[model samples]
Target chain A: MSAPAPKALLFDVFGTLTDWRGGVARAVAAAFAARGAAVDAHAFADAWRGEYQPAMERVRSGARPYAQLDELHRENLDRTLARMGFEGLFDEDERDALARAWERLPPWPDAPGALERLRAIALTAACSNGSVGLMARLARHAGLRWDCILGADLARDYKPRAGVYLAACAALRLRPEETAMVACHDHDLAAARAAGLRAAWIARPLEHGPGRPAPEPEQEWDWIARDLHDLADQLGAPRP
Target chain B: MSAPAPKALLFDVFGTLTDWRGGVARAVAAAFAARGAAVDAHAFADAWRGEYQPAMERVRSGARPYAQLDELHRENLDRTLARMGFEGLFDEDERDALARAWERLPPWPDAPGALERLRAIALTAACSNGSVGLMARLARHAGLRWDCILGADLARDYKPRAGVYLAACAALRLRPEETAMVACHDHDLAAARAAGLRAAWIARPLEHGPGRPAPEPEQEWDWIARDLHDLADQLGAPRP
Candidate 1:
């Protein structure tokens, strides 16, 4: 059966709306090259992102008290650099720029246009693990027109935690059932669905890296589409 | 001396961006007429708004938890109706439609264009006491292109409270010095300045009612302008 129409669409940003892996890898290569460092940029990007969950888990598990994604990303970069034996290669300015790469990731091919269409029909916001500021900067940098920025900082917790999903809904004054969570990752949708929000999966075959298997939905979602455009069509938003 | 340049322009919506007094009066008149009641529409509008601060004070004083402005407005409407000797005249749906009139308040003549100009130069958001959902709907309804919805709901408190100003800045990841609070009210700017945000006062002489004296700045603010257009000009935002 078709799910009831949602009044809002809350999106997962990193892998869903934008190609963070590719964008981060490109940014890393440029930053390192400027510092005369030789590194596998893609590998570096992967290593940095790989720490994302564990870093957030520190807060989620109550070991940390809700640091923003930006701070965690910076710390992760420091640890990753140390492990890669490139410690102290770049100065503080260089390190800061590298960490900010997350804010400048390019949107997926269909994201900008699809978001415009979807926004015309219902409220659209970033419901990600990113901090509110990170989301705002990313939206501005990537031309993603979010109705509002909602995420970890607002909830003071990370994803898969009920607070994140419920906080986004609360920020919009919407009921969980009145909102839909859109993501490429099954785990995100699972958590959203568990929190009583409708879920839609968008396939991003290469979100992780080339040769990575496309995500398979762990459960039946309210809708599944090839990209944001397809999802917009499914949501009955008129194409411009 | 001129103030430091602001990276974001946070706006007060009710009277600064929209003519709430006029809109509310019109809505109230229509609703009462539908119920075959003759009431002083303008007086009723003023009285309804008069309760706004007191209602919010309940939350601020910890006597009540934060409630959405929509709920407060409804309660205020009922109280105002009863005081006007028209209690039980309108049903719940009618009361709801009247309360939602705030969502449909028309933008001031220069608001849409001036905001477009200002937005191109810096981040722009509705930093009002309105709930996130109410602000989002009002933006959509009135064609206010906010970068993000921020304010009361996010802060979980009302304006003139330090938390509200600081919360909006925190959401955008901006320092108080990097943001400017633009409002027509002296009290709001005073509170903003107290919270360390730069303040810009825009004159809305008719905000309260016709022939009402325009608010004179009680203290020196960073910038004082005739309207949003003048503010945009002072801020070096290019006119389209």
Candidate 2:
């Protein structure tokens, strides 16, 4: 019985607003130290984000039709460089600039000032499976000021697929209970509350990096909080 | 030649950054002065913007399928209130709040400081036929700070269609000559330069309000400029 304060929120970029395993383990340790290789750059950024949900479960099981989380992060960076053995050590324009290291992820030091104070209290976006040109170049390289830029190429698919949370609340005409779905993941707020929407969460304890173990909320989420500047101070917003 | 400086620009919201004929003639003179009646609100905002391109040429001649320019401005505001006779004087919730007066139009005094210095040079959006919830409530009621919000509800259709300027440069993945449309209408920069993109224009000499002449550029448009703060000082964009 929670959702009464949403006009829009959406979000969930990478690990809920940047820090994709510390910017793809600092571009996989500067593309394996420009080739004089060493290895374990956060275990190759957890083997390219564990091949991101089995490549969006091959386009959510229809077995691929919708290609683009930047071509499934450049075909899951050639199977995370052939499952970490590092096959043919980078070419095709250095694996297209290491598949744009998830478009240069870096926010999360309070995710760009709590997304400029939760965008003055409402309508924010990037409902990410990433790729409206990788969330418009990761929201201009992580300053993250979205008012538009909905997810998975306007819901062709992906996300705990409720048509990507009802196509980011029908591209803003809203009303999936007037939108909410922020996330740090409780299976993406139980698939955005089974698609009727309204959820919040937050808590990205260094999003699988610093010391690891950061998984907490497993159940009820209408508004949890801790990181996005305490969900923009529990949604009141003012203090930018 | 003039295709070099763009990374993204797009734009074209109702008479290039708002003024929808003086904000839909001050919302059709306050809804016919709350019905005491005193019409001719700028000729009913030019007969509801002259039924906007024959209601997007019935969804670009397929004879209608795609809709949402807020349902063709609520069916052209009931044919601009029965061609100004005021048919049954405003009902369906005051014609759904006068078809949201194009979502509270009003920008254009150098459109929110030249779109905050052309979003600090480049990536700005709203390739407008309007409706991502009426350009996200007319960019939060006209402060207009878009980084994303592509046109014709993600190019379902409308605008001097070239699939609505190549579906807003293929939804930010760009490369319609790296994008650049801007507008004040030289046939919407000649259909965003016949869809290969790159154009600029921006004049808006009080956009059909003052002495009413306004539109000048009939051809050559790579960067014209005069209004969006001289196209953010010819795109160098520093002085806000």
Candidate 3:
């Protein structure tokens, strides 16, 4: 805040600010219940997400055709549903609806407050893997107030790529010093930092509902907060 | 129409949508006149743009460190101005103002009509090498209405790169098939096609102001128009 101030704030979506897991589980639960199946969809939700990284890596490394999260999510869900003894449990329409269920995830308790705080201090934008259209619908569905959205679909490369980070900088017409990345995941922060962006952390303890494993933050950060609300408090931003 | 509809339209900024050359020339003309200088700024404007690709490519290929278009513009302007005998005619403050002249770029005459039409048909977003912050400033400066902005700073790579386009698609939650790239340049559309996006050609014959080279479409496109007004006409979308 002294010399080179941040002109914008880039946020990580998913668990940091939204309850994607809970949303997925709820959608799956309803889908199964309507189908008169007793499948444990909560477990299915966790398992499907568990397979996410590997599936994306396949596309990332060119092990498979260029595939999107929507397609990858569908493929994994289909295989997982069959293994869970829910064969023919749903049709194409149901499957498509479930795939888009991630778009309807609920925002975390502090998301609104944090976004307001960030916006007050600087422009707030989303830098996520979700498509721009998906982000818009998600915003509408979850009532997120993002000034704009940036995702892998925009840069054609996933996070941790400097090009991805740089693309956001280009669009904002800001130098790397002018932007800060706020994310729950440390790896993303590390990438942003490596690209010369300042970093802030908003811890999301139950990103995967406690059972699923996620990488923990190891590096020291410019800022650390219990939640978006805490960060807002520290930043002296307006309360949502 | 049988396919999943595009939820958003991602537009190319520079020549395709906005007349960067004309705008920059006007900015140069105004800046020069404001400083009581009698130089032909229009020539410098043409020469300045000529250096854009090479400078960006230097970063893209690591031949040079990453520099924003603004920085690059200043660098090129200073060199070109000195060469053109733009001596003590302008001071540092005037020079800086001239450098930011890019920010005050005017949209092509067709921009308002086309954007209005696209807005009625789908959410409209700008995908350009201009930074997100730059685009935002330009939007306010030019009164261009965009749902959002995406660019190199937003994604890191330049136009021919897929990051921001993919990011735009992800942020919009729209598949490549569900979104189309709109631009006056063929290289931009070609890249969009390679990424599996549909394309719209919005031609601007006067972008180079008479003698400069312009691009030609190399691939089959979904639609082509002489200008934004024509593009809007084909879509049957009305101006706001």
Candidate 4:
């Protein structure tokens, strides 16, 4: 049976819309070079991102109350840098600038055009773990047009939690059945489905890095497409 | 002395960016006409809006907990229609369509161009009391390009309250000093200033109706201009 059309499309921004891994690595490398330090930037980026879930887990597990992704990002960056023996290498201003790297992520090749197309037919928004400020700045930098910013900060909970998906639907005044969660990760789509939102999976082979195994659709989704362009086509958004 | 440059420009949508009175009046008149009811449409529009503040006041005064503007607007519409001796004149679907007239408000003459220009230099968003869904639909219908939606629903409080203004600022991760509240109403600007945000007053003499006294600047706002276009020029946004 065909799934119903969505009134709104909630997007996972980091891996799906923007190349966060590549962008973060590049920014960290520049920051390190400026401070006269040589470091494995790619490894540093991965390590920092690797800390993402565990940090959010603290909040999810109630070990810590909700803190914005920006705050968690900075903390993760500090710990990652410390483990790499680069602790205190950058001062407060430098750290602030580095923490904002997420705001300057580059959009994937198909993201901007596809998003513009989809937005013409349906309400589109960022439904990610990023804070509202982080998502807004990233959208500004990357030209990702969103009707509204809906993120972990707004829900006061991280993704994979029911609150994040439900909050995005609530903010749009849409039922979960009338909203689709589009993401690259299987876990995200699974959680969205569990929360009653339709799921559309888009594969990003290089999301982790080159030579890594490309993500395949492991489970059925409402719609699975190769990329956002394909997803837009499935949704019947006019081609640009 | 010149005020600091604003990092973000938050707008009051109903009267400031849109001709709500005119739009609502026209829509209501059409609904009445369709029902073969000879009602004074303009007066109906005014009376409907007249209940706006008092309904919000109940929420603001702790007499009622937070309710979305959509809910409040519907309640007010029902009371107004009943008082006009047209109780149950329309079915649920008809009432819903009429209520959605708020979502189709037309933008003022200079609003689109001025907002486009200003957005080039600063983050721009709707900071009205409208719910996110309402603002998003209005923006789509009116072709108002907002970077993100912000308002009462996010704050769970109505405007003129500290929480409403502060919530927008907090969502954008901006200090009140770095954000400007742009509105046609003196009371809105005054409330914004009291909450530490810079305020810009745009004169909309016809906001209530033609030939009605235009509001003059009652207090020293950060900037006072004839309209959004003039405000954009003052802020040095390149004329489009």
Least accurate 10 contiguous residues by lDDT in model 4 chain A: A1-10
- Worst ten in a row by lDDT for model 2 chain B: B1-10
User: Which ten contiguous residues of candidate 3 chain B have the minimum total lDDT?
Assistant: B1-10
In the range A1-240, model 2's lDDT, one tens digit per residue, is 345779889888888888898888889899889999898888778877888899889888998787778877788888888877888998889998888988888988778888878878788888888767678777788888868888777777888889888867886887787888888989988988888888998888778877768779988788999788887877778894
Per-residue lDDT tens digits of candidate 2, residues B71-129? 88788889878876888988899888888888998988778888888888787888888
Chain A (candidate 1) TM-score to true chain A: 0.97
DockQ of each: 0.68, 0.23, 0.34, 0.77
TM-score of chain B of 2: 0.35
Per-residue lDDT value at A64 in model 4: 98
Q: Candidate 4 on A1-240: residue-level lDDT in tens? A: 167669999999999999999999999999999988999899999999999999999998889998888899999989998899999899888888999999999999999999999998899999999977888889989989989988787788899999889988987888999999999999999999999999999999999889987779979999999999999888888987
The lDDT values for all models are 0.89, 0.83, 0.76, 0.91
Off by over 4 Å in 1: none
Interface RMSD for every prediction, one decimal?
1.5, 6.7, 3.0, 1.1
Q: Please give the distance, in angstroms, between residue A231's alpha carbon in candidate 2 and its true position after superposition.
A: 16
Across B61-128, the per-residue lDDT of candidate 1 in tens digits comes to 98999888989998998998888787889888888889898888888888988999998888888899
Worst ten in a row by lDDT for model 1 chain B: B1-10
In order of TM-score, best first, we have 4, 1, 3, 2
| Predicted candidate 4 versus true structure: per-residue lDDT over B126-151, tens digit per residue | 99999889999999889899788887
